[model samples]
Target: MGWRTVLVNTHSKLSYKNNHLVFQTGIQTEMIHLSEIDSIILETTNISITSMLIKRLVDEKINLVFCDDKALPLANLMPFYGRYNNSLELKKQIDWAQEKKEEVWLEVLRQKLINQSRLLFKREKDDQGKRIEEFSCQIERNDPTNREAHAARLYFNTLFGLSFSRQEETDINAGLNYGYSLLLSIFAREIVLNGCRTELGLMHHSQLNNFNLASDLMEPFRVLVDEIVLENQEEKFKQIKKAILALVQNTYPYKGHLNST
Candidate 1:
């Protein structure tokens, strides 16, 4: 009923048929319809999208997301679905996101906490609780940028099993930051579609905190990030493509029924 978000992995085949994005599965190929899709997400070490396809996607107003080795959305293709400032529904969605900002923001925070705790437990029940506490405090701070900055620090520390410096702001890989930014925007768009305010954020700008709701809401889905990262760190990414496909195709209950939509 909204937008379709598709995730493809390393060296995966992507051909658009009408409004479909297709890939090979074993001997059979699977397809995701573009008209039914809100966004297309790709993540992997060796990502190669054809020029012709990319142009077509742009012209069609379909959002195309590129993810990095870390499986963070690196780039996105934005939709031109509205005319200038005359888009009434877009404005209403924006207004609604701002209206229900508090509840949405808090929900994001609580989910983030729960996800982080689950991650730690999954790794080792006796891991460092102190680190989790610190990460939680940083994420809950009144600045979304601060949350990302600090969260990246904590995340990398746990990720690479080493201490990280606050002074570093390196991209996960070359040309990858672009994709992650787009994916982040896609997530924000999803929040807006869910009838939550993308602005009036809980931990974002005081002047105009648009997309903070998106920032808050992406907590549970952060596992998608972790799953991508894990695959990249593997000796050989045999499962990287499979993992991405699984993530995008996986379903669960949201408002009432079980679905990834």
Candidate 2:
């Protein structure tokens, strides 16, 4: 797999040249070997990509994220199918029983709460961490009691003080939303590659959103960005953005294998 997350922030015309992705801006042009790029982030509205290059990127299973005029990610390019029997896999995904889906979602919530508890422990809030751990252990199938919400209320208040609100428009909230959006895109790509629809979720069932599954899968990983924000709470938006992007390279041990999450 490729390792580079290519960011195209400047106005450029992208095309396919030989085996490289050619970028032209004004009088200058540059070539990036396509094999070395894991993903491409079109961070500017002024960028244009050739159809040929787009096809090649899809063939290579390279993730492509597109940002809006305000430089916030809004969409991503996912292929119609995965590398294997995508139709069969999707059928199986659609046929998943509600009982099994609920069971899986119960585990997802359990892990998310566990991670939140660990984050609290790391921040020296042992009492709060124990409470969260208790909540994690008490989670029923599909979180029927909504302990996740109760835990989130305590988690945010204990960590960010009583005044902190994720709903308010603040630099901390902006940084966190941006980082979680990027993480959601990553999870969306993985779901598509596994022949599952991002619109279908294990627990999340927002009718208006297309990335419900991504949101569900990204719950446990959210603590990573939370840690980043805690470490650089006073930093401005730009630095936080760069720090979040840099986190793509960090690997985690999962199921006897290393994962770039």
Candidate 3:
């Protein structure tokens, strides 16, 4: 897989040339070999890309994310056939046992809750953190009682303020939404790269959602975004966005070794 994430923020024209991605702007032109790009984020609507480049991106399994006018991720382009055994993987996904799915979902929720509580504790909100940790233990299979939602309410309220609601129009909400979208796109890319369907989810079953599995898998990573947003509340959205994007480079202990997302 490619290792670089190229972000197109200004007006530019993108095209495929000589096995490279040609980026042309009013002042200069640059070329990056296709093999070096893991993904491309178009943060401006003023850019134009050729169909040839689009085809090359798909063929190389490079993700392409499009952002809205406000510079928030809106949609992404994913490959239809990600691997040679994609049909087999699809059949396996379709045949996943309900009990197994529920079990996996429960584990995912528990990890997410643990991460949230840890963050709260780090911020010195011990009481709320303990409450969230307790909720993790109480979570049932498939989260029938919705302990996740309850914990989220308490967690967000404590972290921001009692008056805070995720639906409200605020800078915090904007940062969180943007960070989550970036995480979702990364997870979706990995899912498709492994020949799994992004629509089949363990817990998130929204009919309108195209990336349900990505949503489900990204739960544990949400707190990372929250931590960055909380620390950089005074910074502009662009700076916060840079920090969130750089999260992929941060190393963490996983399964007895260090790993990066």
Candidate 4:
């Protein structure tokens, strides 16, 4: 239930002191306990951080996301051995059958499409929403029929406009990509924390992709980013980026109770 997300966007000297993150910029100084932090976003190029702080964040299993000059997340720091017996989890991950992976991926697709359908309904596109709902149920193992693509076409067109395409290099696309990258980094941290491999994936098997498993696990959560992009189409600001990153704090139904990512 750790909820604090620290953003270090300005030029500052950051280090670990007395189990607290000490930030000193000019004459102003701030201290935050490590236990209160869930994640840290390094969004500036001018900031300097000590190795001790990095090691502490890793040891504490706190997510550390580094952003590019554009203020978009580019990389993250994840532990190689998050569990006591990391080898055992690696064996379990490899032992997972293809059928089981497909089954899990199918459920993920269903939930993603269902969320897309709900968003469509909220936008007053009832027919498109129902079509997406039907496709959610019809999706087979690994989504062989590619209902997700069809649903995406309908969803984006209805949500934005007929002229809007996800491929387009626009503010909306940038925002979605940024938010999705943040979500991917969050899932990557969780996966590594559980001794899971981020390179292996159930459905997103890409040889060039290093975060395939995170991509698979983050599929359903992409809709949350899409919602943010749709709501802030006028402009893309740091506030919008922070809002998308805060999606991890929002509670969602899991098992029988609501949980935060």
Candidate 5:
């Protein structure tokens, strides 16, 4: 069987039991097979971990990703499996996803813009204490057909503060976002060959798709490297190392369980 992630918080004990996963918030947890774990992310609120668990997780060739107080990944540990044919496929997947992905991203940005606009409007004008409804008509029924002009309008009217360039924010947003997509290509390829089905997106998935679910899961905090690297575009680095243990130590729980962005 392949590995799965085990995120620990709240001072727990963990181990393996014949390929079944087991861990506890208390002491002397049931045995857990190391082989069953694909990875482990240790995030503790008030618990000290045993060294044994760390040793086992490392020895089993399982990945380990770490997070911070914001539930964003601070670091990841992947066992070195030799480079395969995946890189070429990764480039192709990237090219395919770029066009459609941006169309989708722009739609997403538009929604965020509407929300932001409403927030600004509500604060500026008393547009609250009343039911606000959204309709398709809210989107331009006959939006600009002129690509540059349409894009410019969307930038100024829709997204003003997201990018520094006022004149080319739409394209700039597109460029930054498109760059992230290419970045995700690296993640998607790994998750796929790592025996993951990427299509089961955490937030946006229609049926009949097969990869990038891991990409979907990884999106919110994709900017970890971006903010560090001065935006997400940079010549590849050996690792975006953010050290998992100390980072995740500060995070709180999500709905009683610790999760990463």
Candidate 6:
């Protein structure tokens, strides 16, 4: 996997030449070797890209994300076949039993709640954090009792104030959404790279959603984005976005060892 997350915020023409991504804007020209890129975010609609570059990016399994007019992530390009044994992987995914799926989903939710509780504790909200941890312990097979929702309400209210709502049109909400979108893109890329279908999910099964599996897997990581957004609530959305994107370079604890995303 590559380490750099490239963002094209200005109007530029992108092309592929000699294993490098060439960027041209006015009289200035820049080139980056594709081998060094993990993902590229096209943050402006004014940018133009050639088909060759798109094909190269797909071939390299590089996540190419496009942003809307508001400069928020809207969609990303994913390869159709991500592994040499893709057929076998798809078969295995299809054969997953509902019981097993539920068990996996239970674990996912448990980890998410644990991470959320840890964040709350880090922020000095010990009482609310313990409550969230209690909710994590109470979750059962596929969260049939809806402890996740209950925990989320308490978590958000505790973190941001009682008056704050995720539905509200505020800069904080915007930052959170943007950060989540970035996480979704990263998760989707990894899922595809492992030769799995993003449309198939263990927990999230919305018929209209294309990244259901990614959504399911990204649950545990949402708290990371939430923490960044909370710490930078007073800053502009752009700065918060940069901080979230920088997470690609940060190392975190995983399986009793530190690993980079």
TM-score of each: 0.52, 0.94, 0.94, 0.94, 0.32, 0.97
lDDT tens string, model 4, 10-105? 989999999999999997999999999888889987889999999999999989899889888999999889899889999999899999999898
Q: Pick the candidate with the highest TM-score.
A: 6
Query: How well does candidate 2 score on lDDT at residue 187?
Result: 93
lDDT at position 95, candidate 6: 92
Q: Write the per-residue lDDT of candidate 5 for residues 105-176, one digit (tens) a residue.
A: 445434433443343344342232111213212433123433323333333333234345534534344434
Best-fitting candidate, scored by lDDT: 6
Name the regions of candidate 3 deviating beyond 4 angstroms.
none
Clashes of each: 15, 0, 0, 0, 14, 0
Q: What local distance difference test score does each model get? A: 0.55, 0.87, 0.91, 0.88, 0.43, 0.92
| lDDT tens per residue, model 1, 1-261 | 325566676465666566566676457678766566656767675655666667767665566666667766555554334234435655565565553655566556656655665565666633543465455655643445565445555655675456544244543321123323543675765554444445545446455444554555555666555645544645233344444445444675667988762
Model 1 regions more than 4 Å off: 1-62, 66-74, 80-103, 127-156, 164-185, 189-202, 206-213, 235-245, 252-258
Candidate ordering by lDDT (highest first): 6, 3, 4, 2, 1, 5
lDDT of 4: 0.88
Tens-digit lDDT track of model 6 for 1-261: 678889999988999999999999998999999999988999999999999999999988888999999999999999889999998999999899999999999999999999999999998899999999999999999677999999999999998889989999888899899989988998999998888999999989999999999999999999988988888888888888888786677888888999877
Q: What is the lDDT of residue 17 in candidate 4?
A: 97
Using TM-score as the yardstick, the better of models 2 and 6 is: 6
Q: Which ten residues in a row have the lowest lDDT in candidate 5?
A: 128-137
Q: Write the per-residue lDDT of candidate 3 for residues 88-165, one digit (tens) a residue.
A: 999999899999999999999999999999999999999999999999999998778989999999999998889999
